[model samples]
Target: MATARKYNVEAVFKGAPKKSDFKIVEETLPAIKDGEFLAEAIWLSVDPYMRLFVNSSNVGNTMFGEQVAKVIESKNENFKVGDYVAGMFGWRTKTISNGDQVRKLDRSVYTDDKLSTGLGILGMPGATAYIAFLSICAPKEGETLVVTGAAGVVGSAVGQIAKIKGCRVVGFAGSDEKVQYLKSLGFDEAINYKTMTSLKETLEKTCPKGIDMFFDNVGGEFYDTIIPQMNTSGRVAVVGCISQYNLENPEKGPRLNPSILAKELTIKGFVIYNHLPRWPEAFKAIGEWIEKGQLKYNETVTEGFDNMFDAFSGLFTGKNTGKAVVKA
Candidate 1:
């Protein structure tokens, strides 16, 4: 038997997550049996959706999330030793899996053979941005597109892709630092919603003509405000609503009743899992962009598996840039 460390929830989050809410417990793993493989965790991801999903996460159960792990030993011929894969393996240092659905990552994304990226840019968030922007937004040259939560993995990718498609890109973020980061990625305008003008005022000033597309990551009031600023026949990809994730009995934002009719908007709410069959398409496109200096990405790495709660808390307060990863 081998001892494995895992973080489990002791209590559900009340508002913002607290360190006292989680506990680290040691569990012994049985030897790998037939059709089973053992993987050691390399990196774990902290995402906004995880915050939203806890409404149903069983108290005292292992926290639910994804990770990049290397198959250390295997009885399954499909998952051989030294092969890296990503899966929804929860928060554990070692995983005993049947080698179900997992994808191999290209080391070109992050050299040193570290498997962290399978959880971040090269993983779910990357796929989310790719499918939604190209399939939903379908930005055209000179069309104006605005992205909310522009500093995170999906938002950053959305802005860059809009730029690649020759769309004029505008971004709204929580902090000035993130605003600067969005500008560096070639966004035409990056507005800090915290101190700057209201979303409607900023939209009026920055994109006076009206928005042709919107890649929405922060919903609630932000969504309500953005709806009226859209041009006729505009498209919106509602990827995630991170702003409302942490609130206790969250209040609804402004009503979007008249704006949808007025703007004739196409709002599509989606999950990236539906586009897994087309991942290679997205991977190839994003890979080329990274190779050609067109797409810029950043990861905020927090070292130590013991600090998972701290890393997760960072996402709620906009403490990270681009993608947030925890190095085990």
Candidate 2:
């Protein structure tokens, strides 16, 4: 019999997840029966959404999330002993993924590319940024688009993809370094939201006229500040809200959303899962962009699988300069 070590949730999140909320437990695996394959987790993903997704899931269950794994042994014909797979394998060192049990992943996305990227730029966050901003916001060339959380994975991708669309990108990030990073990625302006609370004044200086679109990665006050500055008929793609994720009780939002009605703003909320059909399209473009130097990505890697929780929690505090990941 083979044994697997896994992390089972011992406590539920009260607010922002504390390290004490998780516990490690081990399990012995039954021998693989017909039709089942055993996979080993090679790379695990941690994102801001986990802060919210874990709230309803019960304690004593496997932690939720996806991983890129190697098929170390198998009985299923579709997956051989050496195939690489990406699936919702939870926070475990090993998983049983039959063809029926597996989440589909195309190796073309991560083979020539870095495996960790399948969890970041080439993975979920990549698909999120590509389809949400392009299809929903529909930025046109010379249009000014504003994005918050510019330094994080999804935010960084949104800004860069907007640049590829020939739009003038104004990015907001937590620190001066992230601001500079956005500028280096060819943003027209990068605002350090921490240094200046006067978002309206900053918009006036950066836009001169007004913003045509907003790729909102952080909701709360960030979007509220930018809402009134939008050009008429502007589109906004509501992505993840990291700023409010950790708060046990997210504060009451300012009443600025009402202005959208008067302003005739077009706002849409989306998840990448809804756009899975376009995975191939996103991979081709993002992969080519990387090869041609039209796009770039940075990762904040914390060493060891043991540090996963710390790396995940760091996403909220601006502790990471770019897409945060754990290196096993």
Candidate 3:
């Protein structure tokens, strides 16, 4: 029998997750059964959603995540040996899968054989940005757009895509490096939300025309600033409320109930899985943008699987400038 190493949750997260919440366990694998394939994880994604999911996830199950893996052996003809796959395979060294919730690697997006991107720009994050922004916000040329959490993979992609649409883009990040990184991605202005003495004053200066579209990734105090400043009929796409993810009790922030009606703003919240049928269209457009030099992406990769907890924890602290992943 073959054995695989896996990281399983030992405790349900109460507040912020700590290293003690997880455990590494070794397990034996049976021979490949019909319609199944064996894959070895090459890269694993450490994302903010897992933080929220952990609170309700099975305590003794493998940690929640996605990975890009190589199909080492296969009994399913659809999944050939040596083919690369992207799936929700969790934090494990190896996977035995029935081909459910898996996608074959798209060479156009993974150009030059960079499979790590399957978990970052070219995968879930990329699809989220492409479909959600274009569908919900419907960005127009010359509009002023504001993006919160602008340094993460989805937010960064949103900013760049807005730039491609000829929108004047402003971004907010937690650190000076991330602000500068957003600027490098052609954001018209990048503000450090943590260091800014007055977010209202900064917005007044940078967004003289008012925000025409808002791509919100972090909701909390930031939402208070953004909602009131939006132009009439502005569109707001709610992706993730990362700022409130780790809280044991979600904090109450400035009220936006009146502001939405006053500004006539259009706001909608979405999950990527809700738009799964559109992934092919999203991948085609994002890949074309990448090939045409219209899109750029970055990743803060941790070196080993043993350090996955560190990488996962970094998302809350703004330790990663873009997508945070573990090289397994």
Candidate 4:
């Protein structure tokens, strides 16, 4: 028998999530069945999507998330004991899984010290940046690409990949530190939106040729400002609306349909789960980029499982520079 400690949603979020919204519980696990494995979490991911998902989630359900865990005991032949795996096992210190949606971590790609990346640049965020940006934006050399929330796990990756594609990259982040981080990633222009006197004016000056492709993460005023400045036939990948995720009610924005129609913009919103089959393709490409020194990644890791809520809530406050993960 094993025991697991996990976080359960205690209340639905209002403006932003609070510690009182979750409660930690310990459960004694039953013995592993014929094809089950017991795993202890090594790293847990706290992402913006968790906040959005909580809106529709039932109270008392385990807080939704993904984690990298080690197989401590196994009855399944496919999953050996001591194997590391990444799975949607929630914010739990331990999990008993039958391997339905679990993937054994590729040792060749993730070494012992780098295993935490299984939740970051080499994992879901990497896949999202590679697959969604490439397929949706279809970036071309010499084109200008604008990324909002540009210092986040996915956004930072998107900027670098665009640079690798020879696109002129302009990125928007919240703080001066993040702007510098974006510049370090080789963004042609990094704007601190919080300090900009006029976002429209700064964007117009920075992207003189007009934005050719827009990878939007923060959707609100930034999205509104970028839409009217796009070149004709500009492509927009609506990856995330992080700005609106914490709102108790949806904030209305200026209607951009006129700008979209005038420019004949192509806009598509995507959820990464729909592209699951192509994840390996993304991982392979991103892994190679990392190996070649063409891509770099950072993680803002919180040290303890008890601090999961703090890490999760930090996404809205610009507290993380790259991927935000918790060591369990």
lDDT against the true structure, per candidate, is 0.86, 0.83, 0.90, 0.93
Report the number of clashing residue pairs per model: 0, 0, 0, 0
Question: On a 0 to 100 scale, what is the lDDT of residue 246 in model 1?
Answer: 79
For residues 235-285, could you state the per-residue lDDT of candidate 4 as single tens digits?
999999999998778888888999999999999998999999999999988
CA RMSD of all predictions: 1.5, 1.7, 1.2, 0.8
Please give the ranking of all candidate structures by lDDT, highest first, separated by commas: 4, 3, 1, 2
Kindly report which residue stretches of model 1 are placed more than 4 angstroms away from their true locations once superposed: 106-114
TM-score of every model versus the real structure: 0.96, 0.95, 0.97, 0.99
lDDT of 1 by residue, 1-328 (tens): 6678998888878888888878899999999999999998988888888777775455788888899888898999988898877889888899899977866555556565435657766788998899889999988899999999999999999999999999999999888888888988999999999998566778999997799998999888878888888899999999988888877897867778688888788999998888789887887788789889999899999999998888899998888998999998
Point out the higher-scoring one by TM-score: 3 or 4.
4
Best by TM-score: 4
Model 1 CA lDDT for position 150: 92
> How does residue 302 of candidate 2 score in lDDT?
87
lDDT by residue (tens digit), candidate 2, 26-127: 888888877888988788888888777774455889888888888887888888887877788888888887666365456665674488888888888888
Indicate the TM-score of model 2.
Answer: 0.95
Inter-residue clash pairs, candidate 1:
none
